[model samples]
Target: MSGIYIHVPFCLSKCYYCAFYSMPSLKRKDEYLESLRQEMVARKDYLHGMPVSTVYFGGGTPSLLTPEELKTILNLLHDHFPVEADAELTLEANPDTLSLEYLEALNAMGFNRLSIGIQSFFDDDLRYLGRRHDSRHARQCIDWARSAGFDNLSLDLIYGLPTSTADQWNRNLDLFFATGAPHLSAYALTLEPNSILTKRIAMGKAQPVEETAAVRDYGILCQRAAKEGFVHYEISNFCRPGFRSKHNSSYWFQTPYLGLGPAAHSFDGKERRWNAETLDGIRSEYEALTPENAYNEYVMLRLRTMWGLDLKYIRREMGDAFADHCERQAAPLVAQGRLSRTREFLYLTDPQMLFADGIAAALFY
Candidate 1:
């Protein structure tokens, strides 16, 4: 029910669409790893000794770490934290960075899950995303992972690329499903400010994202995933039965989790704390959780997932009056086909989930 997340904030190169806190230099790897060790010691009590069921090594590309370096970090976590025996330990891998040997080392170190970043099967789309791996490496990495005995595998794919046609996207999905990857985290590309893609769009060098096209592609993806027997458990995640991500499902279920390293966020069913953007600054802001902080966090995070806001949880955490106010405000949207409710839970319907943020804000207490 509880989780630990470690953000490995180093990448070989920056992707054009990436806005996450990451540095493309390995110059400070030793220093950063030492700092992370110190962070583990400093924030050991953040989860209050909850048995950590999940430990995710998310990017800037966790596979970039050498096996020895990764072992040191994992050893430190096991030494300091209450990581469960069957923890779903996940490492985000870039296709070019994973090899049979590296994956074997990872398996030996108890990393059971691999979320491989293979954004597209097409070489052109890979180039557009500024990905380091070619399409061949992407295909090869999945085979190597299976050969290394990784069953809990997920592949991250992207659609709605300016260079992608409907046929091309379908072909990409065809190849992806053919690999027998049990889980898929496919996303529609977004152009955000300060990203190279955004800058290119602003300067007329790249075509603007066709919103209609993106939505159409999303619908197509959802339909195809359903036909392939993958559950659309979360907005962007699809998985074969029993293959849903435990860590992400914990987030939606409002379970407690601690996030380590730079730009990671933590929640403990109440309060939320996020590490700083820069590595040094992350160390400095390790201990700042308050009661009022928890309430605002419950609202923001709970509203982001398919679970939405449960009045019972709000009444128990907040107050009955606040819960009533939320429901009263949500009534209009529910009637307008943007929201849906059972007697126990209130949430956005499938069509309305695309506007979840705006709907949540409209009914915010």
Candidate 2:
């Protein structure tokens, strides 16, 4: 299914580990809105007349946008794109910005999913992450969303702090499951080179994330999620039956999607493009993928999900040479007990999923 992604690039504050582009103030909201509309009009055909099944409003705290502002963008999308009648509309929210009235307005405007960032249900953890919301606000955010008639809820959590303990991570999971939210997107804290968190480490002001801590937390996440009856559909995502994020699935499934706003990315069957701000104005940069690049991506993305890599599809679409290469590459891992396979598919073993990226890289064309 085709999808549309809108990056709301305004945030009240920048988190230490965040690398996504965002303005720390909303002073340019009007300019951003206008530019976003221009982008929608210019790239309306990116999906090639496909019916859009999902629309996701992500980052710099999309919840910062007023409901009226969000409605305007959604209306424009419907006017220019063939939005499906039952499209899954999702918005990423910071718990500090949600209220009963605000959530009710969002629900009224057809936002069926709310992805709230409630990273950890501990005040100390929130402080360490530089989150503005306390555990109390997070609890209140969930209550308000439910009171406003939202049932398709997703919560974001981060584990693998440099100082993380098993008890702390377990507490976070316990609190999360108690909320009864249908979806959880849990990630190990990653400190990119340019991120503030990494910079702090370079300057000796902060400690970097520990690999041992991350591995331990990920194991806990997988085991607990399984016992909780949540499916591990993606590397960092878990959901109750029928609660997967369709918009996000479009990325791994290699479906076409149009991305709007500065720093957003768009992909068609053959090309991938993204926007950036320049001295002149926002402009696009893109590359036409080579066969090898496409093949590498196909392997990388497919293995991130529980569905694994389809050998049949590889043989049918990418030819026998590529399929043979896959077979040769997978043989060792399969024997090592890191991967298991059927005649038609190959998958990572549960204990080895955190090594998925490294494994995918090894299979690259």
Candidate 3:
């Protein structure tokens, strides 16, 4: 089935490593919300009567919205789309922004899931990342959420910080596990171009990420999560059984989804489209995206997951000859133990996921 994603592009403060389309300024919140409402109406026909099984509010910080504003958007969604009765509605919140009352209201309004940004439980790491929340807020928010009756909670953590040692990372992981969260998404720290961290590194003001240390630390992450009974469902996601993110899984499973608001992306089964990142630059047009582009996207998304690509489905959907080309290209890597295949699917074997993008590119048409 289809899903809906709402891009709330406002943040209280810009993080050093973030490159997503977010602005710290709240000057256009009202205008942007209006535009978002209009965009939803415009794209109402995009899903073609398929029930929206999931609705996700993601962004710079979705918690930036006041409770009323958030409710208004949700109400509009329910009105416009045929939302399923048990739809998995998720809202991304910052630790410092969500109040107990606000969370109570959110639960009352039918948001069943919360994805909180609790990057690190250390003050120094918070400072390093330019995050607005402290260690205390991170700890308090989880307690607050649990008390608010939000059982389906997911948290985001980043490992491989420049100053984070193996022992320190373990402590962070220990604290994270202690929370008993059903879902977790942890990622390695990367310096992207044009981000504040990258600029500082170029100017010798900040240190570059150590590749060797990152790989070693990622190994630690895997071991700890597995010991805690969490499955490494995707490269950066861990969940206990029955707790995998249904919305995110839909994306990996190549299900149709329409994204609303600025910088959002939409994909029908065959094509894709992205809204402009800014209001002024956005043209009012929704057109069919290319099939070749869709094929590349399919490969990129599927290869990132643990399931990898299904050969039979690819052969049928992308042509048997192209499927053969993918296998031929991946043959050497499979022999090298960096990739593997069953009768139906081809996947990265542990070590290769470190260079998943490179390996996926090698096999791409």
Q: Compose the digit string of candidate 2's lDDT tens values, residues 177-211.
A: 99999999998898887887888888898876688
Q: Native-vs-model 1 lDDT?
A: 0.84
- For model 3 the local lDDT of residue 19 reads 89
Q: Assess candidate 2 and give its TM-score to the true structure.
A: 0.97
Ten-residue region with minimum lDDT total, candidate 2 = 274-283
Compose the digit string of candidate 1's lDDT tens values, residues 1-365: 58999989999889989998899988888888988998899889888888989999998989989999999998899999888999999999999788899999999989999999999999999888889999999999999999998999999998889888888888999999999999999887998788988987788877777877677778778789889998877778889998889998887676888888888888866566788888664543434445444444555566656676777887887777777877788788878877788887777645455556677677765
Ranking by lDDT: 2, 3, 1
TM-score rank, highest first?
2, 3, 1
lDDT of 3 at 314: 79
My TM-score estimates for the predictions, one after another, are 0.93, 0.97, 0.96
Candidate 3: regions farther than 4 A off? 281-292
**Best-performing candidate as measured by TM-score:** 2
Among these predictions, the greatest lDDT belongs to 2
Local error of candidate 1 at 100, Å? 1.2
Model 1 Cα displacement at 255 (Å)? 2.2
lDDT of 3 at 290: 59
Candidate 3: minimum summed lDDT over ten consecutive residues — where? 280-289
For model 2 the local lDDT of residue 306 reads: 93
Q: Candidate 1 at 112: error in angstroms?
A: 0.6
